[model samples]
Target: MKQSSTMRLSRLVFLYAAARLAVVAGCAGAAVAGVRLFGLEVSLTWVLLVGVLAGIAVSLLALRRLRTRINDEIRIVDNRRQDPSKRPRP
Candidate 1:
């Protein structure tokens, strides 16, 4: 049997969280490397903070996109399950 929309949504949310974490970590690492490689004077704390914020923004955008797509499918499924007659004609 296929998973329920709620379960699928939960999985997608978890993946979105993991991706955000990775983005934050990668950005921080790159910032640190850039500072060291070029002998630039910059605070690691600021760099990491920026990275985290950017990651959050990116994740929010992705989440919105994913939610929109999944919601469309979920709605269609619910409509069909609740009342066959209510479903849109193909």
Candidate 2:
């Protein structure tokens, strides 16, 4: 069965957002653990900076997967737009 374009787009967006949130959370947790366990004197700003950098790194790594999914959805949408017969019947 074919999936709707909106459904595909929504799924991709949701996945991307979830991945980003996970990255940020993971980084923050790690930074907190380092400070607590190692007795490292770290400021909130340093922790946040590390988190942001880690988040960007994670996002970059995941970008290819996200791009592929997005591209596939876009291609499906474009094909549907070009072919009236493939469009949903109302």
Candidate 3:
């Protein structure tokens, strides 16, 4: 049904967002820790910037499967919208 598809899409979006945020946070924490461990002085802004950039790069490789699934689900929903026959009956 359209409702189920929409719900699934929503769930996937939530999961992706949570996963991305966790990765970014983890990377940011690591960046801060690494700086302290090496006794290197760096601004918080620069460390956070590096963390966010690294998180994006890591997510591209790590979340490819989840991203593909999300894209496929989006295409399916879009197709259903364009074709009345594919739309669920109330």
Candidate 4:
């Protein structure tokens, strides 16, 4: 089955959004865990700094994945656009 350009773009957008949301939630959860395990003795600044770092790491990973996915999609679109016969018959 062939995919339309709009469909591919929509899928990429959804995947990107999901990845970002997951990363943010994961960072928040980790920060909460650190607080619970380390207690109040640890400074809030340190915990938040660590959490922010983790979030940045997660965003970087997601960015890489997004880049790969976008590249693949662009390749597919280019190939489809180049092959006229592959397009659906009206």
Candidate 5:
């Protein structure tokens, strides 16, 4: 039963990672798309700069989200531990 839950959790983690990568690529593509729409000449430097910036932005947001979630979980655990009924009696 534990193994089944671990596997499911791992699958979700992998999918979320893949989705983030796709988002970074999509942001880069959007930059290129904008250039093409305006009939501007494509530049390698421009594409790379835009892509790198987008990836950094996404990574920072992800880290902030993860940190917030972890903090919230810790509070939940601490609150549960502080409850008298939930405590183990010696």
Candidate 6:
């Protein structure tokens, strides 16, 4: 029932969050490496800021399918919740 579906939704959300965090970290590492490769100095704070922005952009494209699936599932769950007749029996 609702509990099972909710758990599934929670898992999807957790996966999405983890993916975003990983991308952000990867971007930060890349930023650091890129700067060093050019023999340029940059503040860590600025580099992290750039990384987060880049991560957001990349994730918006790369994670589109996953995001869509999550949204669809949320919509489904919400519909079921709003329509008591559609809700599963305990």
Best by lDDT: 3
> lDDT for each of the candidates?
0.72, 0.81, 0.88, 0.79, 0.67, 0.86
lDDT by residue (tens digit), candidate 6, 1-90: 345667778899999999988887888889888888998888878888898899888988888898998998898889989999998799
| Per-residue C-alpha lDDT of model 2 across residues 7-87, encoded as one tens digit per residue | 888889788888888877888778777777988888978887887788778776867679688888888888988999998
Model number with the top TM-score = 3
lDDT of 3 by residue, 1-90 (tens): 346777888899999999988988888889988998998889989998998889888887888899998998898889989999988799
lDDT of 4 at 49: 76
* Model 2 alpha-carbon drift over 4 Å, by segment: 82-86
**Residue lDDT tens for model 4, 1-90:** 977886987789788877877887689678978798877676767777788788878877768969688778888788888999888788
| RMSD of candidates 1 onward, in order | 5.7, 2.3, 1.9, 3.9, 6.4, 2.2
Full-model lDDT, candidate 4: 0.79
Distance (Å) between predicted and true CA of 80, model 6? 0.7
Each candidate structure's TM-score, on Cα atoms with residue i matched to residue i, is 0.62, 0.74, 0.91, 0.59, 0.51, 0.88
In model 1, pairs of residues that clash are none
- Note the residue pairs that clash in candidate 3: none
On a 0 to 100 scale, what is the lDDT of residue 71 in model 4? 77
Say which prediction, candidate 4 or candidate 5, comes out ahead on TM-score. Answer: 4
